[model samples]
Target: MNKTIFITGTSSGIGQATAQYFEAQEWNVIATMRSPEKQNILKNSERMLVLKLDVEKPETFNEVIEKAIAHFGKIDVLLNNAGYGQHGLFEATTSEQIHRQFSVNLFGTMEITRALLPHFRAQKNGSIITITSGVGRVTVPLVSIYAASKFALEGFCESLSFELASQNIQVKIIEPGNIATNFEQTTKSNFAADEALTDYSDYLKKMDEVFKGIYSGGGSTAADVAATIFKAANDESNVLRYVVGSDLQPLIDIRNGGTDEQYMDVLRSTFVPEN
Candidate 1:
């Protein structure tokens, strides 16, 4: 029997690419997004079922998961791919934005995984893959809150990996440095700003340039990440983290290979150079 992979955030970017990649590889795919009515790109796709799934809405999760399983027989993998980064100075960001950021990025992943745990536990076999970012393991200016969410997710998966290991359930996280996708554009366009704080205006403008050079200077494509996810899904290893994006790898190395102070200095020199 063909394996089924249920994925969230399939409307665009890495999620869309991964759904396509898996379908081409002959796997059953549950390609879910917030607004399924607005998509037709995968309308005629064979062996792929596109559905509505807004991760922020936990109330709707169980229904979607049940529908996916009923349609595909059984799901072998769960790809937590639906999330957005809330970008801005911490003070500039509102509580609502922070709640929404974590709601989808961290909480949504947790809730969905919780809903699926019973199914996987009973089978005693499964893979849970989450797409976090390179910043999850490090940090950068202008994205403090975004980094926090990913960081929480990283820790969550790391701990859950051990709990699920005995049952043959693999918990994996994909950390991409930066990617050439509309993901960045969407993040920037929707960034929250507190206009009342004019004092930080100049700093914000400068950080914009810093973010561009650091995040978009060079990175991987959504397809590259999709390929990496495929490899991780099939590897059946006890390993937990898989890093993608060539541009982000070196920074991860800096974090992995040195002391916290040294890594902070490197970031400071790179983004906050003293004048």
Candidate 2:
């Protein structure tokens, strides 16, 4: 029997690619987005069932999960791939933005995973894959809040993997570097600041420039990330995390091999000093 995978944020990017990849392999793909009424390529596929799912709305999980199980009979995988980036200096970010970012990225993912845990526990075998980022492992300028939320996920998934081991539930996180996606264009900027932060405008501008270059096909493709997620989902060994993209490999090597001083030097060299 073909396995069923429930993926969030399927309107585009890695989620969409993952949906296509699995469908090509004859697996049932439940691709979800906040608005299913929107025209999408996945909507036309016989193997794909595009559902409505807003991660922030925890109330929708039960109904959505029921629909998924009914459509595919059983869900072998749950991909928590829905999230957005909030770019701004820590000081410039409002409380609302911080809460919103965490809500959608961290808490929302957690809620959905929690809701599905019982089903996975009952089945005694399942995969929970989350789309985290390299920033989760290392900090970056102007993305402190976004990094924090992913960092929270990394820690949560790591611990959850251990806890769910007895039930044969696999918890994996995909930490990819910048990937080519509409994520940058969809990113909400909250950099509005008063006169006191005028000195940091150039640094913020530089960060925006980097995002444009990184997300516009200059970095890894969405398929690259989807492949990583598929590997983590299908792998027999209980690996905790999979880092995707060549751009991230060097940084991971540095993090794993470099000394403290080297790490600090690299950070300083890459990020412009805030004057």
Top candidate (lDDT): 1
- Could you tell me which 10 consecutive residues in candidate 2 have the lowest summed lDDT? 186-195
lDDT tens readout by residue for model 1, 1-275: 99999999999899999999999999999998999888777663668999998888889988998998888888899999999888878988888889889999999999999999999988889999999998898788888899999999999999999988988899999998788899888987978788898988777777877776676477799999999999998987777899997777788888889999998889888677454
Clashes of 1: 0
Provide the overall lDDT of each model, using Cα atoms, as 2-decimal numbers: 0.89, 0.85
Clashing pairs in 1: none
Model 1: ten consecutive residues of lowest lDDT: 37-46
* TM-score per candidate: 0.96, 0.93
Q: Give the winner by TM-score.
A: 1
Put down candidate 2 lDDT per residue, 1-275, tens digits, no spaces. 88989999888888889999988878889998998788447874667888999999999899999988987788999999999888766787789989999999999999999999988988889999998999998777778889999999999999988988889898888998878777766665444355588877677678777666655647788998887887887898967879888778788788789797898788787675545
| lDDT over C-alpha atoms for residue 69 of model 2 | 90
Q: How accurate is candidate 2 locally (lDDT)?
A: 0.85
Which runs of model 2 end up more than 4 angstroms from their true locations? 188-196, 205-217
Q: What is the lDDT of residue 39 in candidate 1?
A: 75
